[model samples]
Target chain A: ELKVEQNPLFLSMQEGKNYTIYCNYSTTSDRLYWYRQDPGKSLESLFVLLSNGAVKQEGRLMASLDTKARLSTLHITAAVHDLSATYFCAVEMGTASKLTFGTGTRLQVTL
Target chain B: DAGVTQSPTHLIKTRGQQVTLRCSPKSGHDTVSWYQQALGQGPQFIFQYYEEEERQRGNFPDRFSGHQFPNYSSELNVNALLLGDSALYLCASSLYGDYGYTFGSGTRLTVV
Candidate 1:
């Protein structure tokens, strides 16, 4: 069974601070995805890291993947109040279309 | 162009009853995937449909079944629903062999 674990399941940060949410998988995967979900809303795709050492950034969010280490990271740079939401990292096992997701990290950015 | 869309934004069902949910994938997407997400948890893969057939399924039981239409739309049927079945049913669409997916708003199913 492929299992995904995320660290700091709950995060409360001040504005202008930085934090990184880590996702670790038990098995090898070829793709990793980051999504953001607000209360009562659907998920919004944040980043898709397809290869080892692949990094993608948009605005204040950046995501990186390391296949060898079976890990991915979503880094929040200079977080702002509007960045508060639940962040999830999902891993796609080799040749499988399904994704195994981590427990998710709820980020509460305070002003 | 619209992203993935699901029907019956919210539903309420009784235990032992059956329910059907619908989904329309994003334009030009040939694959549709279903996921179950409980409150405060990450979504769990239920199944995936492609080419009007069930190509992949997750750890769900037989009570959870689905069908894909020729137009790439899909329906998810749950029979003999249990209280545990109460959750948000999310439909995601992606092109075959693609690495990214677009998700729908999801149907909030409440089983009484």
Candidate 2:
């Protein structure tokens, strides 16, 4: 079975600080996705990283995939309260893209 | 456009009972996948349906089943529910061969 793990399951950051959430997987698929979910809400797609060295950015968030290392990272820049939420990284199993997700990192940005 | 939508936003059922959750795929989507999200956990893939056929399934038991209609909508049925089965059930939709998925808000099931 494929296992995905994320570090620092809980994070508390002050405004203007940057942090990175790392997702390490046990397999070799290059397809990865990042999603954000607020408490009691559904997941919102953040980025779809499809290949090694693939990087995507939107506003204060950026994501990258390093398939060769079986790793992916979600980087938060200049943290703000509005950006606080749980972030998940999912890796596609095989070419079919059936995602196996990590435990997630709950981020709380405060002033 | 309106995204993927799931019905019965919340439900409560007694153990040993059965429950059905419905999902309508996003406009122009041709595949539907169901996932189970326990409290504070990432969504786990349950199954995927395409062309009215079940194409893939996860490690779940047979008691968890699903069906897809010609319209690409889907239903997830859980029988003989256990307390562990109570969670947020999410339905994700996408085009065939498309890696990106649109997820629904999910149905919260509580077993009493």
Candidate 3:
């Protein structure tokens, strides 16, 4: 069984501060993805890291993957209230593309 | 372009009842996947359908089944529902061999 775990399941930070959410998986996989979900909403894709050293950035968010370590990270830079949401990291299981997701990091950014 | 589409944004069912959820893949997408997200938790894969066949499945039990149409649309059926079955069911679509996926807003199922 593949297990994905995220750290700091709940985070509360002030605006302009920075934080990083860590995702560690139990198995080996080359494809990792970041997704953000607001309360009661669907997930929004943030990044797709396909290689061991792959990194992707979008506005105030950035994500990186390290396949050898079976770990991935999502970094929030200078957080804003709008950035408050639950973030999840998913690893593609096999050729079928099944995703095993982390528990998720709920970020609450306040002013 | 429209992303993944799921019908009946919300539903309420009683224990032991059966429920069916539907999904339509996005344009040019040939594969459909279903996931179940419990409150305060991440989505868990249920299964994936491609070419009108179930190609992959997760740990869900046999009570959970699905069907895919030739047009790439899909349906998820959960029989003898339990209270724990209540959750937001999500549908995702992607092209075959493509790692990218587009998720649907999800159907919130509340089992009483």
Q: Which segments of candidate 1 are over 4 A away from where they belong?
A: none
Q: Which ten residues in a row have the lowest lDDT in candidate 3 chain A?
A: A91-100
Residue ranges of candidate 3 with Cα displaced over 4 Å: none
For model 1, what is the error of residue A29's alpha carbon versus the real structure, in angstroms, after optimal superposition? 0.6
True contacts kept of 3: 0.73
lDDT measured at residue A45 in model 3 versus the true structure, 0 to 100: 92
Q: Could you give candidate 3's per-residue lDDT for residues A9-57 as a string of tens digits?
A: 9999999999999999999886888999999999999998988889889
Report the Cα lDDT for residue A21, model 1: 96
DockQ of each: 0.72, 0.75, 0.81
- CAPRI class assigned to model 2: medium
Q: Tens digits of per-residue lDDT for model 1 on B30-112?
A: 99999999998999999999998898899999999999999999999999999999999999999997778899999999999
The TM-score of predicted model 3 comes to: 0.98
Error of 2 at B82 (Å): 0.9
The top-ranked prediction according to DockQ is 3
- Worst 10-residue lDDT window for candidate 2 chain B reads B92-101
TM-score of each: 0.98, 0.98, 0.98
